[model samples]
Target chain A: MSDSIAIELRDVVKRFGDVVAVDHVNLQIRDGEFFSLLGPSGCGKTSSLRMIAGFELPTSGSIIIHGREMGITPPHQRPVNTVFQSYALFPHMTVAQNVAFGLEMRKTPKNEIARRVQEALDLVRLSGLEERRPRQLSGGQQQRVALARALVNHPEVLLLDEPLGALDQKLRKEMQLELKSLQVRVGITFVFVTHDQEEALTMSDRIAVMNKGKILQVGTPTEIYERPNCRFVADFIGETNFIDGVVIGRDGNYTVLETPEGLRFRGLAARPLSDGTSVTYSIRPEKVRLLTPDGALPPDGLAGTVMSVNYIGSDTRITVRINDRRIIDVWEQNTRSTLDRNEYWQPGEAAVIVCPPDNALVLSE
Target chain B: MATLQQQQQGRDRIRLALLLTPGLLWLVLFFALPLVIIFVYSFMTNDALGRVVYQPTLDNYITVFTQSLYINAYWRSIWTSVLTTVICLLIGYPLAVFIARSPQQWRMPLLMLILIPFWTNFLVRIYAWQIILANNGIINGFLELIGVGRLPLLNNEGATLIGLIYGELPFMVLPLYAAIDRFDFTLMEAAADLGANKIQAFLRIMLPMTMPGIVAGSVLVFIPTLGQFVVSELLGGAKVDYLGNLIQRLFLRANPINWPLGSAMAVLMMIVLLVLIMLYFRATTEEER
Candidate 1:
């Protein structure tokens, strides 16, 4: 990705009657970046994508594409194309005609339109079925046609609204990788909107996590998953065990937090927090290690009893009860090929849960 | 003993036949029988007293093909029907789109407004149009009040067209509304995202997608308008003869009711409409390939 921005949303606020769908969202998408607006349904992710596509004009604030103010500039006049979630391929037109629609609209030369249409179909690997109508094609094929139709226009940015959402799980995964590679090959900025966090994580170069019409955080997938700045982002992106506590003081680079029960824990903080500030200490299950409690307890270790042990295929997940009111989950990878009953943690077993301060985060409540 | 499955299949067949008996009987009795009678009548001879003779002849068909009166009526009927269909489509397409695109709460009321006219009798509504279009009617009265003087609002082909359009508009709108309602409007956005302006998007996407509705509305309006004599009689002052007026005269009002000639004319009209409708569906659906 280049330093130049492909699209920018400046305090964009979109209201549908009384409901604010996108509230004061500000974002700068760099050129050639695979950026994703990730959120749950009705979190305004799709609404934000629609605003960038010029489908919905912002009720207030401004949108700029390539430094051009897109105020009241209709979708057609803008230099961007969209791949709709429905695929929206014209049922009456054949695959070739559907792909050529944009070029025809622009009044491109007939021969050139044909050539580009063929190239686009080939790009999506749909060259042999040009004469077939959209209905004649399978769901995956139709999705490719929708992609080709938009890409044939060679717009500055391609906006996709859950384009792979209609596909089955296996096909969805395949398309996610294919779409990511296609973006790299084409080198056009992509603004993808999806509710599926895994899909966003797998494809997006940077993700903007949104909720309740506001953007909670925008960062790289690693940053979003490992160092989520807020509690919602940390919870929404992946599963994490949250322990409510108050900050004590800093120990080297880690911030020390004390629970209501006076159990002390250390974690990294995205921003500096004053002493005595209430916060939630979050740590992923995979990041915590479980010991048999037969040796001397580490300084950050908590003695607990194993509540339940679920031996899923790759990992053995154990719920360790630290106190009467609190339980923390720990996942240990089954590195050994043996299936001996004694190898896995059993219920009622005494265990020590040790969480590394580097892998843990102190998120504001 | 027969297998249980075979016995069940036999019983199912008998039940299916019993269920289909009434509908089949109705079609054979009222529809197919009349069509057969008309075909036979068209090939029979009619005596001077207008009584059908047993002798088979093609004279009725020949007369229908050669006579200027019959030819003129056919042309006039076809022309008026085409005009009515076109007018209905021009008005109804937008109206249906408007209703279909309306807010969820408003759509039902708007659709109800289109259909509320059907609560009254068709003839009663046509008569109301006559009252409104007549020279001394509400329109002319308003014109005179505005000091524009009374214009010739009725007793003309224009008035007949107005009446026909008024009667057939709902037919057009209903089917178009159904098609537009079923249409995924996201396609319009897709088209626009592909650099098509509003007009281009509509022409390339919306119009073609909603074409099934257009074809249905046209047929619904055109077929009825072609056979209609009531509107022309009341609104056109019976100044010009249409196919329906001619057929009515031959069957019920002429000096010697010519049944064979009327049957031949009716059969010819049916053939023409069938061919026209087939061609229309073909032409509209050809682009789907």
Candidate 2:
């Protein structure tokens, strides 16, 4: 990705009657970047994509595409294309005609249109079935046609509204990789909107996590998953055990926190927090280690009883109850190939869970 | 003994036959029998006293094809029907799109307004149009009140067209509304996203997708307008003769009424409409390929 911006939204607010679908959203999508707007349904992710596509005009803010103000500029006038979630291929037209519709509308030379249409079809690996109507094609094939139809236009940015959402799980995964590679090959800015976190994390170069019409955080997938700045982003992206606590002082690089029961803990903080500030300490299950409690407890180690041990393939998950009111989950990978029943942690065992300060996060919601 | 499955199959067949008996009998008697009678009569001769002669001849068909009076009526009927169909489509398509795109709470009430005229008798509504369209009627009186002298607002082909369009608009609107309602409007957005303006998107996508509705509405308006005589009679003041008026005269009003000639005309009209409708369906569906 370059330093140049492909699209920018300046304090955009979109309201449908009384409901604010996108509230004061400010975003900058860089050129040649695979950026994703990740959120749950009705979190305004799709609405944000639509705004960039020029489908919905912002009620109170300006949108800039390539430094041009897109104020009341209709979708067609904007230099972007969209692949809708439903594919939305014309049922009447054959695959070739559907792909060539944009070129024809722009009055492109007929011979050039045919050539580009063929190239686009080949890009999506749909060259042999150009004459078939949309109804005759399978779901995956139709999706490819939708993609080709938009890409053939060669817009500055391609907006996709959960384009792979209609496919089965296996096909969705396959398309995610294919789409990511295609974006890299084409080197066009891609603004993808999806509610599936795994799909976003697997494909996006940078993800903007949104909720309730506001963007909570925007960062790389690794940053988003491992160092989520807020409680919502930490919880939404992946599974994490949150322990409510108050900040005590800092130790070296880690911030020390104390729970209500006076149990001390240490974790990294994205921002500096003053002492005595209430916060939530988040640690992923896989980041925690479980050990049999011996003589004295180690620093930041909580002695607890194993509440449940679930041996899912590849990993054994155990919930440890430190006190009567709090339980934290720990996941241990099964590195050993042995299937011995005694190798896994058993319920009612006394265990001490240790959370590394480097892998943990002190999130201020 | 027969197998249980075979016995059930036999019972199902008997039940199916019983269920189909009434509809089959009604169609055979009232629909197919009349068509057969008309076909037979078209080939027969009419005597001097207008009684049917058993001897078969091609005279009625020859007269229908050669006579200027009959040819003129056929052309006039076809022209008027085409005009009505096109106008209804131009007007009804937008109206149906408006209704279909309306808010959920307003749709039912708006559709009800379209259908409210159906509750009254057809003749009663035409008579109301006559009153509203007469030279000294509602429209002319309003014009006169506005200080513009009354214009010739009635007893013309234009008035007849107005009446025909008024009566047939709902037929066009209903089917178009159905097609537009079933249309996925997201395709319009898809088209626009790919660098198509609003007009281009509608022409290249919306219009073609809603074609089934257009074909249905055209047929409904065209066939009825082609056979209609009342609108021309009541509104056109019988200034011109149409195929329906000629057929009505031969069957019921003319001196020494010619039944064979009327049957031949009716048969020819049916043949023409069938060929036209077939060609229309073929032309419209060919675009899908």
Candidate 3:
């Protein structure tokens, strides 16, 4: 894939009356990259996607697609197509006719339209059902038709706004993988808008995590999960245990934090913080190591009592009460396939919770 | 177990009969009986003393089919109704779309405004149009005040057409509004995203999708206007004689009351309307399938 920017948004802001739907969102989507706009509902992610599709004109700032600034350029003139959230397939047209609509509008020759429509349908694995109307197809089939309809246009970029939101969980999961593969196969810039964090993580080459009309973070999946810059990013992406503390010292890249209860721990911070500054140390439950306190406690580890233990098939979740007040979770892989009670921690048992210094993340906010 | 199943079936039959009784009774009394009477009357003759004679005759039916005046009236009525329907569709489509796409707060008010004409007595509203289109009435008065000569606005085919379209505009607009209102606007956006310009999107996506409403509105206007009497009588001042006016004159105003001829014309009008409606339904249903 080329690294040249396929689409760029410079301080794009969209306001509906007094409510700002999208704040000053500046984005650089590289050519042939599967970029995802990830957030909860009403987080301006879909608004950003709509603006890129030219469905909406920015209230201020400018959007440049392939280096040409799109100012009041209607969606029909833009070199991008959208797979609407509703799957928005033309109900009156057959699947093939719907797929051929764009090329027909462009006055492409009939033979070429037929060839491209077939290829697009086959790409989405919907070759046999070309004659069916949208209502005749299943939800998944309709979604495939929508995908084919948009892809047949061969636009420079493709905008998908929660296209698989209506599908059942099993179908959604299947489509997510299929969509990612399709994007890779087509090699077109895909700006996907989805509220499902896992979907974004699974499909996107890079993700922009947005909140309240603003993008909070943009990075690769690993960077977003491991090095979340703020408390919101940490909580939104995945489950993590937060230990509130004040910075006591710095050890190389790690910030040493001391709890009000006088327990000390070390974690990495996005930026260096002054000593005595209040901070929250975050560490994923899976990163924490649980052991019997009496058996082999790490010298720097905190001691706690196991409040609860849940056996969740592949992993056992152990909630430990530290300093008699704070409850921290520790996830342990169920490596032992045998169903033995002794293999997992029991409630009210003494335990030591420890994590590698690099796995812990410190949030100043 | 056999007795229980039989009793359940009997109870369901009674319940179904109870639910259907009133509607069936109404249709039989009002619709079926009147149609049968009209059909029978079409084959009977009227006496010279303006009284119906209990004599079956083909002469009245022949006169209706053969008379130039009746033929011209039927043709004029059919063409005028067609014109009215087309005009309603052209004007009402955009208006209905505007109302349907309007903000939620404005939608009900706009719809209520369209329905305001229906609240008044139908004749009174047509009478109001008569006054408005009259030479010395509101519109022409305004025109004369604006330094333009008073054009003949009333008692003509043009005035009658305006009246028909004005009276039927709500029928055209309401159904179209209902269909457009229920439409998923996202499809339009999808069309635009698929490289369809505004006109293309409207023609292929919006227009075809809203066809049920168009057919419904057209049928409502066309059927009524074909047999319209009041608009032509009042606005056209009997200058524009349509099938409805001819039937009225034949039954009441002619030197000898021609009940059989009028009844035959009425039956013929009903048959024409039924055929048109059936054809429309067949075309739409086949397209849907």
Candidate 4:
């Protein structure tokens, strides 16, 4: 592993009896980076995170933290703290007491404990709540307290396991921004786990999408979203309208694909393809635009009707019936939408859907 | 509609009152009325043939405080009970923790082991202690065979204390185990991750978390130890005279004239227990807030 890595799991394996929770996974987290392990439930994301936190030991491999193999360093002795899913604040301690706990454990002087606890609490925007017990606080407040407790320890890494899962959607989004900014301000390595794809994209510096205890792909949010390496990666990240096709041959930087709807489209070569190879491609809904039947298209074209029009204030979502057999979603910005059924179009009326060739992501058939 | 609803509310209140009347009347007639009679007995004088005479005096209580023989016995009994309680807690705490921390698969079987001693009747257990702790009992016989002389164990204060602790240990273990096991284990781990060593985490986090169980267990152990007679009688024979033994003697063995004296003594012990438990509960609630 590189010396620049804060924590690294080398061929780690975890098994719970007959169930292999985490297969042999290898990952290296860079120093002071906000990394997220994104996956659906039962996908081994949390198991991998737990191994890094030392809550669990990898079954068949070593875990290195701070450039040292943590042979048997128990969770308490490790220079890392975790913000649990439920916050797991000490019920008996006041907010101040809870925050001061880590420092006090190291025999920190009483005054120093008080100072650091207050500083950590203020960092999480929870001040003057020192005397309140965990039970007295709201869920979001408790979550903040848990964060402060970990932050006050000044650990090299913070392990957050679905920290915002319990909050309502409004609070979850707000906390997403809060966590992202806090990570930047603190600049400590954070290993977060979540099944919420949007949250992973919004908060993570890099995301490792996991499935069945293995990393499908890991990359920057834009890279993973714009150029998914496989069909699962493309489908899991966001709304992508899949188009089945066959690859004929490659053009210097693109591939010409013949679709099932008797149309040929030119697209960026997602992977090397041979002549006569069957393939599939996907494009985001936002990439497809609704046009008049006479409007021009860049080789890739499908004639369809407006099945259902959802008039969102900022963007209109229309399900377009492509070739009278398939439906491709088209999202139009409210500012650019010029369709008026009474004047130009109506439901079940034929229209043309144009998708730029470069926007199509080649996927496995 | 509103009047009908109000009428039902009134009727429910009446029904609740009626439901409580039987138990409350029974307690007043049997429990409260006996205490009143005992209070009156404590003040009255007994005649030559040990018949009750309707004259009031504070003579028995005064004698209890003024006489060294009675005063020493009272303090000695209290000291032994305290010793028994301390020893029971020392041994029971670790055992309870062991059972509590065991995996779920083993929990029921281990708890059953803790409860199994109670299956053989309580008195039989006390008598079993006699066969082991007596002067020429199994323990002494073993000692003799192992080239040691017979040691004086039974009919001694230490013997009663041991029996008392052995008998009370399970009662202590169950409640403490329940409390410790019910603790949020993740909180302890959180404390550790924050920077606590194992011991500090337990002291600052685990200790305070399971305090309710400790309080309940201590009360349960202490209250019964305050007035245990069978273990004291079987192990100490006639020499061990705890409050329970005193109560028993007044009713079944002691001079009949001294019945009122023993009743007064029993009432005093009951008052002491009530006050101690009340103080304990107050302290716990204050700490909770």
DockQ of each: 0.85, 0.86, 0.82, 0.66
Off-target runs (Cα >4 Å) in candidate 3 are: A295-297, B1-6, B282-286
Q: State the lDDT of candidate 4 residue by residue for B59-121, as single tens digits.
A: 878876787756665676677766876787789888888988899899899999989998899
Best by TM-score: 2
lDDT (10s digit) by residue, model 1, range A136-230: 99899999999999999999999999999999999999999999999999999999999999999999999999999999999999999999998
The stretch of ten residues in a row with the least summed lDDT in candidate 3 chain A is: A291-300
- Candidate 1 pairs with clashing backbones: none
User: Which candidate ranks first by DockQ, i.e. highest?
Assistant: 2
Which wins on TM-score, candidate 1 or candidate 2?
A: 2
Per-model fnat list: 0.93, 0.93, 0.93, 0.83
lDDT of 3 at A37: 93
lDDT of 3 by residue, B93-134 (tens): 999999998999999999999998788998998899878988
For each candidate, the alpha-carbon lDDT, in order, equals: 0.93, 0.93, 0.90, 0.83
**Candidate 1: CAPRI quality band:** high
Weakest lDDT window of 10 consecutive positions for candidate 1 chain A? A291-300
In candidate 2, stretches whose alpha carbon ends up further than 4 angstroms from where it belongs are B1-13
- TM-scores for all candidates: the values are 0.96, 0.97, 0.96, 0.89
Once fitted onto the true fold, the runs of candidate 4 whose alpha carbons sit more than 4 angstroms away are: A1-3, A243-246, A256-266, A275-280, A295-298, A323-325, A336-346, B1-12, B94-120, B128-159, B236-239, B278-286
